[model samples]
Target: MEENRGIWVFIEVTDGKVEGVSLELLGAGRKLADKLEVPLAGVLLGHDVRKISAKVIEYGADIVYMADHAVLELYRTEAFMKAVVAMAEKYKPEIFLYGATPNGKDLASAVATDLSTGLTADTTMLDVDPEKRLLEASRPAFGGNIMATILCKKHRPQMATVRPKVMKALEPDASRKGEVIEEEIHLEESEMRTKVLQIVKETTKTANLAEAHVIVAGGKGMGDKNGFMLIHELAKTIGATVGGTRDVVEAGWLPHDQQIGQTGETVTPKIYFAIGISGAIQHVVGMKNSELIIAINKDPDAPIFDVATYGLVGDAFEIVPQLIEKFKELIKEKGGEISYV
Candidate 1:
């Protein structure tokens, strides 16, 4: 373990820009590195990724390990895993963090398997013990009822896959300078199992709840489909996105993509409205990290209020309508057009 030193974050890139989760992990890695008194580094993979190494440094990494190759242009489990594992084996990092995206999970799993090390998945919280040099990775466990902190005691490099939007990225400073080390790995087209034939992006309005500043979410307490319309009405008035609890999705009030809970998308919006939600543990685990949680429910003892900044104990039916009207009036005063009808 003497060879392993710095903390490394996998900088996942898509199209051209670096993924938000990668930057977030860099911010997180910065803190861990400071505590452990080690350098914070970023592992960047893909063709034409040299320029991205600068952005990674600006985001808090002290060093950037870049691998640029034709075969690495697209994300394939085989080519990416080979390059990443090679880098890990050559220049050992004491701690490695990857975003819990589709590609991230696949790559992390394969690398962990090859290295014979522990890899925690979907981690929500992260901390480190400088004394033991243990990377404490915490996540919702037992169906979101309890938080289990995982530690890789016997592993040389502690690895974790953190969910996107769960961590915040540092403000990039272009003035900050760092080192960029170029790495190379041999990859053959025939050896790879999957090929990137075409990249077709979704044309529909994707549910970007993770990035929404304000979200109005409902639950089964919303009664029926028509009752759920009130949620949409308020969301439209405030120019916010509409989300739902697991029960609402099961009831066909919203699609599964719009659900916010342990089994759904985790969100950390600036302001979150929990309308007609009972605040089950599964639901709270997803949105408890929101900057400002405003819960509206008739039950005073509801669990959601435990983490909410403001608790409105009243019927969402009565309060939501009045709230919509107030927002409309406020928008009008600000010279903005808003219609509740």
Candidate 2:
């Protein structure tokens, strides 16, 4: 723990830009680093990623440990893991965080095996003990019924993978100054077991519920597939994206991509409408950071109301149609088009 003194967030870059989750992790890392009075660093690995590395500093990284190599451009598990392990061994950070992204999870699992370190996945909360220098990684346990805080007291670098949108990022400051440590990676193509043939990105509009400004989400209380139409109707009138709970997805009322919960996408929408959701911790962790939360359900004691900024104890079936009509009239008067397709 003495040698491992800094906080490090793995920077995720795609299409020549830093991912939002990585920036958010930097913000979270900044707070932890400040609490521990340690340097906050970002690990940036990619070909010609120095430009992106500088941006990580602007996002609150006090130091950026960068490894730029041809094999690092595309995120193959083998190449990224090798580079990251090399950096971890050399510098030795106290806390290492990665976005719970596909690439991040893959690399973390592989590297954890090699490094013989404990990795807490899908961590929703993080804290550090300045006295003991322990990273308290808290995550949902028992099927999201409770919370668990994991401590890597014996480990050097306590690692965790955090879901996207679960953390907030600081405002970028172009004037922010930081140090850039360029590390050489001696990885070759022959060492890699996988290659990026073609990156097929999902371009569907609803693929990213996390980026939506307004979200209208339903839950099992929605009852049936037909009953869930009210969610879409209301979302259409308000120009908001549609989302559902894990139960709604399991019932085949919506696609898995639209689910908002621990096992699904995490979002921090400006306005979130929780229609018929019972406010489970599993679902709340994904969207508790919403700027405005409005919950409507027949049960007044439903847990969803606990986190809701505004709560209406009424049947969503009865209330949603009225909401849709009202918004439709309002949008018509304002000449604004609905966002729902």
Question: Which candidate tops lDDT?
Answer: 1
Q: Lowest summed lDDT over 10 consecutive residues: which window, candidate 1?
A: 202-211
Evaluate all candidate structures by whole-model CA lDDT and list the values in order.
0.91, 0.89
TM-score of each: 0.94, 0.93
lDDT of 1 by residue, 108-212 (tens): 999999999999999989999999899999988888778899999988789999988778899999999899999868988788889999999864322478778
Error of 1 at 108 (Å): 0.7
Assess the local accuracy of residue 44 in candidate 1 as a C-alpha lDDT between 0 and 100. 93
Estimate, for each residue in 61-126, the C-alpha lDDT of model 2 and write its tens digit: 999999999988899988899899999998888889999999999998998888888899989898
Off by over 4 Å in 2: 205-208, 336-341
Q: Considering only N, C-alpha and C atoms within 3 Å, which residue pairs clash in candidate 1?
A: none
Q: What clash count goes with each model?
A: 0, 1
Per-model C-alpha RMSD: 2.2, 2.0
